[model samples]
Target: MRLYSEQRFGLVRACVARDGQPLLYAEGYALDPSLTLWGTRSVARLSAKSGRIGFLKLADGQEAMTDLSDPDAINEGAALEIEIAAEARADKLPRARLIGMADGPLRRLSGPLPLIERLKSQARRLIDPQAVFEAAEDPDALDIAEAQAIHPSFDLPGGGYLSIEPTRALIACDIDMGGAGEGMIHTPRQAAKRLNEVAVAEVARRVRLSNLAGLVVVDLIGNKHNGEKLTGLVRDAFLAESPAIACGPITRFGILEFSRPWGARPHGEDTPLKAARRLLWRAVAEARSDAGGRLKLRAPGPVADLVRQCLKDSLDPLTPRLSVETASVTEVVPVR
Candidate 1:
């Protein structure tokens, strides 16, 4: 397994690729990582959402998560040692989350453990440190733009294209064979089937790439007779990528709904998830390359907060080489 990490524009973005396939995309929100568990011990704020118990950490909105469906609720702002849990494929609170409390004590979780730690634990295997990329110098390393474009809708490989829209209700995906483009067929059914085939793979990747969880409605073009036959194809496609997703029966209308948590919007304004990862990496590299005991990071509050929180693990090997310093610290060294 190889890891590619980058930091730029105050946000950090990281991707994990194995066997030449990108399996994971992790971003930072400083407060709202699509899935971020900050410090093992955090103050919890309780609430109710969709009849389920919701927990929020006032200090970091990114850590806002829900508790299991139980009558017991923790007092708001009560500090507790939180345990991390991961849901393999379902989207309603799918992905890694705080399942309960850890047995040990802590000084506020030492600030969210490095994402690499979580990534490593999930894989149950060590990452290739030699291949651990900080940027483009590594041959297999994909630039952040290419990494960000891993979404099928944005990275359509042929004449066929897809339009994905996320709403409060569900995510809607529409496939357009883009008619005159490459790999398109003359027969309408064949073209629709071919397009749907391509869409199956693309949709599967998109769902995982976007961290799209919750209810997802995919609209493919095909004859009603083909819907049943194609259902297995669609289901298989998603299963290859994530078992957490389950597709509902297809309607004559050619609509299929998938259940997963709603991920970050694909086409809207890009959130800071990627940028957070980038800054985190850049700071680490700069820290390791620096001569002083202090590594200076100069990002705004959110960006700096993410770097300070997520780079904990990577900082260890280089600790004696360099230490962490916020932009505000100006006596010894300064970085912008």
Candidate 2:
């Protein structure tokens, strides 16, 4: 876990890579001990909507004064990590490291899961664990690191794929069963079931990784049995990650509906300009950290152009110490 410089790294994710393939990941939240539930008011002043998520306790006849300066301790994010790590480790063979984050208020992770663990309870093998605590080491990690602003599409293990979209009405995931399960099963019905099985598992994984919540509509291509099987599979899939998930019977259109808690914002709200600024800082930091290497930043056109100037204006002092480049693209990468 790490403490984020909200100004620089907007939505940071802890990514574990098995070789070059992007594996499991979790988003990072700021860990400032000084930070509190109330930003500008005391508990007594907190409105019903603005009130925090804890209870106050006192002894009989004891009257306590509201101390706006000191609020309750907050480490649930860290605690969750610790619990997840433990659960992930029961199978053994994976190692975890709290790298880059120093012992201070900036630490963001808390958990027992090590460097690697089985991707899930049903996976046959454990993954080689490695977290992106600092900066992304490759283009894939950088690209898939954060999901809030990421494209909704995700590739499955076989040939099928998913396109996730957060629509105004609900979160929609359309599964296009490609050749992935074609040759694996002989009959069309069998192939549909095969793809349905694979799609359900992957959809569950994607939902958790992307932290996509609320009314979710999944469109799968298959028959009634295939849809029914998929509905059960999805329920079982989210049983651990989100037990509160409510899945119902599939419709004639092969749509499965379910809802999960909107625990937190999947991605922090960062304007493109802010993202551009952070990219510039990343480039400079990378360059400085590496005395002679050049760090190239690939981002959308507007962001690249904006950061190019940021490098020109604010980063002048570090010019001699750093070598950086920014390339423009059509899509924006939240962070690298």
lDDT of 1 by residue, 1-336 (tens): 666654433334566666566655554432333223422334344433334555554334544455545535544444444433433222334222444544332234444545555444433322233444422234235453245444435535555678776665777788776752444445677767766777766676555555554677778776564656566766665543355556678787778766753333342334334444544455555665564545555555564565555555443454344333556432223343
lDDT for model 2 comes to 0.46
Give the alpha carbon lDDT tens digit for every residue of 233-286 in model 2. 887766554457788888877788888754323433344654665565566556
Candidate 1 ranges with C-alpha deviation above 4 Å: 6-12, 18-21, 27-112, 121-141, 144-152, 180-186, 237-243, 262-336
**What RMSD does model 2 have?**
12.7
Q: Candidate 2, residue 198: CA error in Å?
A: 1.2
How high is each candidate's TM-score?
0.58, 0.50
Flag regions of model 2 displaced more than 4 Å. 1-13, 16-143, 147-149, 181-186, 226-228, 241-243, 268-278, 281-336
